[model samples]
Target: MSKSKKSEFRPNDYVVYPAHGVGQIVSIEKQEVVGIELELFVISFEKDKMTLRVPTNKATEIGMRGLSSPDVISKAMTTLKGKAKVKRAMWSRRAQEYEQKINSGDLIAIAEVVRDLHRTDDQREQSYSERQLYEAALERLTREVAAVNGADEVAAAKQVGDVLISRAAAA
Candidate 1:
């Protein structure tokens, strides 16, 4: 890769690479792959006990991005505490749209889904499909928050729940 196009990855950076979810940059190294010299972002995830070495130049190309800013994450938290926006549209249609957003690897979109699907106090039971989407969105959002906040997944999830629950009560 040309120096002009060199990777923006930095050591200790928290990045999300779509398919892999949350991963910590364990190291950056120069290695010869085949006949070319390449820089790699060494990322590790404990849940899968997997280590992925993504070529620096290919980071963005592979949907890798830095963690959201604290302010952005904070906004997402506030959104979670707000009322859900249930579209009266067909469930299958909404599900497809939500799935696309979730797979798009965007934190804000995932947060929107979490906020919109969240069931408040004494609400009717969620449909099976609704529960599935909520879980996926919540998982994705929490993983990114965990990476950005330097907290474990469970802790991050709890943090999200607390924020939303508090806001729900205040409403």
Candidate 2:
């Protein structure tokens, strides 16, 4: 009761899907969903479960985007290790802005979150919410890095984490 479309994805392509960070074009396939045509791309991650997707053109503008360039990813990774302003403003206010940056899917905006929320090793563990938000930002950032670098998601995440951890210790 459904039709499948030929996939237009190739290996090592970089893509960003707002909340999910960046993922490579792992594979594409067609499946039936409610008696309608559905295409999907299979994406892998080191930190999270693998994900599936359809064509970008057919998607409601989500899923399966090429990863960012190495230079761009580098900037984000480096930026995260830099000093940033931690607004003394109430968290509710800052959180709103953080949410905005994560959703923007712009590497720099996401980087800001990573930089601001980053906790040093000497610092006490982050609050539950802070850790949650940091993971979210890291995942998003790592996804892009993994996709672009052709590295596993977990490795990419560790790379970013190591940098942040070291930066915090030094500060």
Candidate 3:
């Protein structure tokens, strides 16, 4: 790509930032530092009330990406329907891994977190931190799925919840 070309993201375009969940590209900004000009993509996360500015050249390197394709979302849904994989590691270690996967900006990894932490009827309750992580992953996954499907977050969440509930029932 050439520097003069337009960025892949545009204003009002929803994007996924690795550390954050769903954000919209607000605008492109140009700044001068050390007499060098830099263009930045300003993203806003309404749910988090946070704004992130990423350099145009560093966007991909930092794992900023557009919404997932339908095929990828289908795969993630499939992942949700599959059995959860709870590792034998300690809770602290597993929590760390879960947090890492949530921040990795990968849909399937986030799905795994949701699947593992999900509580079925008559199942044991989750630890506070486990619930926190589960909610975080669920929010992240649901936001993308919502954006892709043009549905509200609650409905999207229900859709995902239905998958989990049915899977647990079958298992």
Candidate 4:
């Protein structure tokens, strides 16, 4: 690995994997793969009950990153309070966009997805796919919020929901 590519992650550190939301580095171990010794970060996603091994050298390249800072979290909260932007494009195309945003591991982009897809009780109901995408985006956002705030997922989710509700009332 290049000097700049040195591993910045350590065991027990919480990190965000682009496609997997938040996970902890449970350990760093070495294994022989194809006769080459590779160092891996063993990440455990408690919510999903899954374990992932990512090579240390490739962590940054794969978009695995440390948790978002407090400032970023605040920005995401502000984003949630903004108006929702629903495009007139077809649902399938929009859904693909939302999915990409959620998986991009960009907190602000995920917030945009949440804002765009949020529904108030009085608004027209969401279809099954819409509901699924909304929940996924919401979950991804809440997980990072929870990790950054050192709070439980439920509390983080409530905080996000409150922001959305306030936005709805203001609109």
Give Cα distance to truth, residue 23, candidate 1, Å: 0.8
Error of 4 at 60 (Å): 0.3
Q: Write candidate 2's Cα lDDT for 1-171 as tens digits.
A: 125323345655555766666555676667788897766666654345767565545543453345567888888878988897789999889888888888878887888898998876666788878788877887788777776777887898898888888777767
Candidate 3, residue 131: CA error in Å? Answer: 0.7
Best by TM-score: 4
- Per-residue CA lDDT of model 4 for 1-171, tens digit only, reads 567665589899999999999999999999999999999999999999999999998899999999999999999999999888899999999999999999999999999999998999999999999999899899999999999999999999999989998899899
Question: Each prediction's Cα RMSD?
Answer: 3.0, 5.2, 1.7, 1.3
Measured against the true structure, the TM-scores of the candidates, in listed sequence, are 0.79, 0.70, 0.94, 0.96
Local accuracy by lDDT, each model: 0.83, 0.72, 0.91, 0.94
> Candidate 1 — which residues are off by over 4 angstroms?
1-7, 29-38
Q: Give the residue spans of candidate 3 off by over 4 A.
A: 1-6
State the TM-score for model 1. 0.79
Scored by lDDT, model 2 comes in at 0.72
Instruction: Please give the distance, in angstroms, between residue 46's alpha carbon in candidate 1 and its true position after superposition.
Output: 2.0
Which stretches in model 2 have alpha-carbon errors above 4 Å? 1-14, 24-55, 58-64
User: What ordering of candidates by TM-score runs from best to worst?
Assistant: 4, 3, 1, 2
* Deviation from truth (RMSD, Å), model 3: 1.7
Q: How do the residues 1-171 of candidate 3 rate in per-residue lDDT, one tens digit apiece?
A: 566434578899988999997899999999987998999999999888889888888888788889999898999999999888999999999999999999999999999999999998699988899999999999999999998888999999999999998899889
Which scores better on TM-score, 2 or 3? 3
